[model samples]
Target: MGTFSDPTFRDLMAQRPFLRLWAARLAGTSANQMLMVALGWQMYDLTGSAWDLGLIGLYQFVPALTLTLWAGHVVDRHHRGRIVAACLATQCIAAIVLMAASRGHWASRELLLGMSLVFGSVRAFQMTAQQALTPLLVPMNLLQRAMAFSAAGTQVAIIGGPALGGLVFVFGADKVYGLGAALLAVSCILILLLRYTYVALPREPASLATVLAGVRFIWQHKVVLGAVSLDLFAVLLGGAVALLPMFARDILHVGPEGLGLLRAAPAVGAVIVSVVLSRWPLRQHVGRTLLIAVALFGLCMVVFGLSTSFLMSLLALGVSGGADMVNVVIRQTLVQMETPDTMRGRVGAVNSVFIGASNQLGEFESGATAALLGPVGSVVAGGIGTILVAISWRHLFPALAKRDGLQAR
Candidate 1:
């Protein structure tokens, strides 16, 4: 029914789908990371304010939420590979538009925001298809490991892409966008190479009715609702990583390069842990383990907030990233395993909304709170809130602590 986890790197390489998907994810995410940094830097350079930098993240997310549900319905019902390919293709077009704007030629902020809206729309589609499709590409026993591998790829983009982006931006952001477009175009090509349609379950077909059924199903499932709630709260409260530029420049005096490193630190730690997970996979007591990991993640955020030393701050953020990976693997497994096969795409869409709210909203929260409480206080308070969420969630889902990974038939 499944493959063994304890395999050589060569054995892991034998899985063609895994290898292709891995490469595609890496290339796509690298471009995504580079675009994020380039866009933020360009906006900040143009406006010369931390709040403006925050708005860049905000603007991208606001429009994305509007399309998430429809994207999910389409993903669940349609050919995922084609959908993903289309999304990547759309993203490439958006990147080209961004490149034009990077020439410092746009007369109005509305133009930039419009491009961002389109980019976010494509991403909303891409994410829904990608999340739901991954489980189908690998065995149930290997779901967490596969997820861990995907997480590691994201880490590479998150950690390494910025360093590369910093160099590119030092020269010109237009060049960065150009490279990002190239990368995404290449990812679309690779995605076309995958036969994802073969893996999806053939159902009675998808419709608005089926999509609504998925939402009602989620509403009825207490465990899922609770887990989603916990994650949303903890992440929304504790995500201070978005404010790293301010910490690096104003507080620690590292400039852009240092800001890039600070931004990359968490990904570095996540990569280290994720590599281990690819080999070891998640074992028993998965739920309790996730709770503990989230608690530790919260503590690391608190430590990062209090630290003035750049290295110490980086280390703290790294620990948070590492711990958060455990939660990611477990939660994703829970979603994939417990969810009915036909509705995976819709569920993935719901999860994406929570993720967007937590991440993008958290960026806004950091900016607004920083204006009031100062950056350090805002981060520290967020960590405390995350810890409280972990404790509360643990009290609510005692059985989750006793569960184990799924076994496919």
Candidate 2:
């Protein structure tokens, strides 16, 4: 296990600007996770309908999808730090509004849905700005390690946030919202404190061509296109997260608490692997490593689908998370390193769309397949599909497959 005293950790921590950026991301992500839990619980409490709960996600997704391209354009042309801080501030305001509504007994389904829209909109820009800013904060050689560290922080937040929210719920949802607001406020301050030299690109007029430049860039770069698409199809087919509830209740017979453990399994694995990677990093044959990691992820999912034992299932999910962390670190480092600074925001924007699509659409795909083939069959088939996709990509995108390093040639 790597410790804070490790030279690698010490080197990364020495990058003061990236440290602040990483801390800000950790705080902001934790707040976002808490907000999602509170929103879901409160919305269900109000409407008592699963469909309404589904609508909340839809409300968020629709706005993010519609605005993400423009968000990229804005990120490239403006101050990324200020943009991130502003997004956090917007989220802070939303949390405060939720807190007031909950305490005043005026919280309603419409109000929650509206706030979801605000979150989704702000996230489109925030995500774009953050991605574009990371490369600017650290030296190129340390970028992968920095990304790994960032992933570790994000995984920790994802694991702890909901658990913290659940604990705070004993006091009431308003308290949860209040806590989320405080966290967002802190994140906003940290981002504002961030220092970087921003090279202002020539402002291009907003046009269909300018807005769609990100899409065009991805389409043109075969290696980037393959990496991005690999994630999309792999997770879209292989993801079992949506069926976790069914597994906990029916297959595992562990109920709600077991469900929480199952959900945390992947994140736990991810965090461990992230820490290791931050220290060691990937030195060579990174493309093949990425492919192998995806394949391993699929195999883990296959084991998880077939296993009847809770411990086995947890083990499978944990390994899958580790595999995913490997994939994430490589792909992110590759994309950011390969793209020029002027285009990183746009490329990152397109990359964000791919990620968002894979997650949201992956869940929908899982649920639909589960309805038809049952959960086990759905997961097994998806895992098999993912493996096949990885194998096919080795041939389909030779540039990506043959690529040997995270650094751009």
Candidate 3:
């Protein structure tokens, strides 16, 4: 019942601290979007090899996967706001170095990848802390709206960041890097402006046991485990993004412009859905809704795979994006609502790893399957696999399937 036109949305937005946090998310995510574009172009410019282009993802993934547990541990035991600020500061420094490297022609492939590694490392901490901090800023009733609005910001960034990066890159690589640094600096300032305070968990001595606790907690919580793993496997098996280029170039024969549209289609869909969700939140059947959305995502993937027509393909991808946004809001809300503050950092870390796995590993899966089955067959097979995963999850995780809403029990 919370439309943007309604007082609920306006009331939530009017809160000073929450608005500040929202601004920080927008600024930081936009910078992330710009950074990805610039980094990819720089990598390809340095080495024409597509393999190295692929390694940029790998470089980022390795640190996020490896450091996530420790990052969560630090988040719980420390001031989350300070931790986020420090991470942003580190990223600011990295951006400056990258800008200098580009301007001085001091950049090597190794140096670029190393910077990518550093950026990834810092991002793990920043995201974990930020996720944990969000609940602290908004009251329970407004959390769902807050997340939807937050998601809209990300979709906007995803849609615009590449275009912005490309425009700045036209001027100079350093200028692109400078823009990223400046945005990150602004994000850091906004986070500092947030009046929300952190209530840190009691300090505990570092131990292997402490680091592993998040994994254990998730394992024991059936709903959380089910929600997280559902996304993991569904995305892993359903991932058809890596095959889009093949579809655009070979099947659709749309070339570069068509490819750009195809890539943007999902984000466009996501933006629309996110805006709508922020206005008209899903207040009932949260678990079932999530499952339905993901299953539709799988079906859309199949439709996309089979389509030779460009418009049809775009429509299918758009629908898939819309469905995925639903999954994102539902899954994120479930995780946040179910988690205790003491465990939020660890749970967030677990969620982050699942996300990284689904994205990075999913790409690899798509590419390998495409090579084995041809792009169409590979995508179709992945879609089928995703549907199967959804079906199995419904039966396997009945708790998640039966759950009614996002309100904490």
lDDT top scorer:
2
Cα lDDT for residue 198, candidate 1: 56
Models ranked on lDDT: 2, 3, 1
Instruction: Using TM-score, give the best candidate's number.
Output: 2
lDDT (CA) per prediction: 0.79, 0.93, 0.89
Badly placed stretches (over 4 Å) of model 1 are: 1-5, 8-11, 40-55, 97-111, 170-174, 197-209, 249-257, 367-374, 406-409
**At residue 192, what lDDT does model 1 achieve?**
92
Give each model a TM-score: 0.87, 0.98, 0.97
- The number of clashing residue pairs in each candidate reads 0, 0, 0
What's the lDDT for residue 184 in model 2? 99
Question: What digit string (tens of lDDT, one per residue) describes model 3 on residues 1-409?
Answer: 5335688888787878878877888888888889889999999999998999988988988998899989999998999988999898898899999999999999889988998899889989999999988899888877888888888898898888888999999998899999999999999998877776666567998699898899999999999999999999888988887888889999999889999999999999998898888788888888888888888999999999999999999999999999999998888888999999899998999899999888988998999988888999888888888888888888999999898877997
Model 3 pairs in collision: none
Model 3 lowest lDDT segment of ten: 1-10
For residues 267-379, write the lDDT of model 2, one tens digit per residue. Answer: 99999999999988998898899999999999999999999999999999999999999999999999999899988888898999999989999999999999999999999
TM-score: model 2 vs. ground truth: 0.98
Task: State each model's C-alpha RMSD to the native.
Answer: 3.7, 1.3, 1.5
Candidate 2 Cα lDDT to native: 0.93
Clashing pairs in 2: none
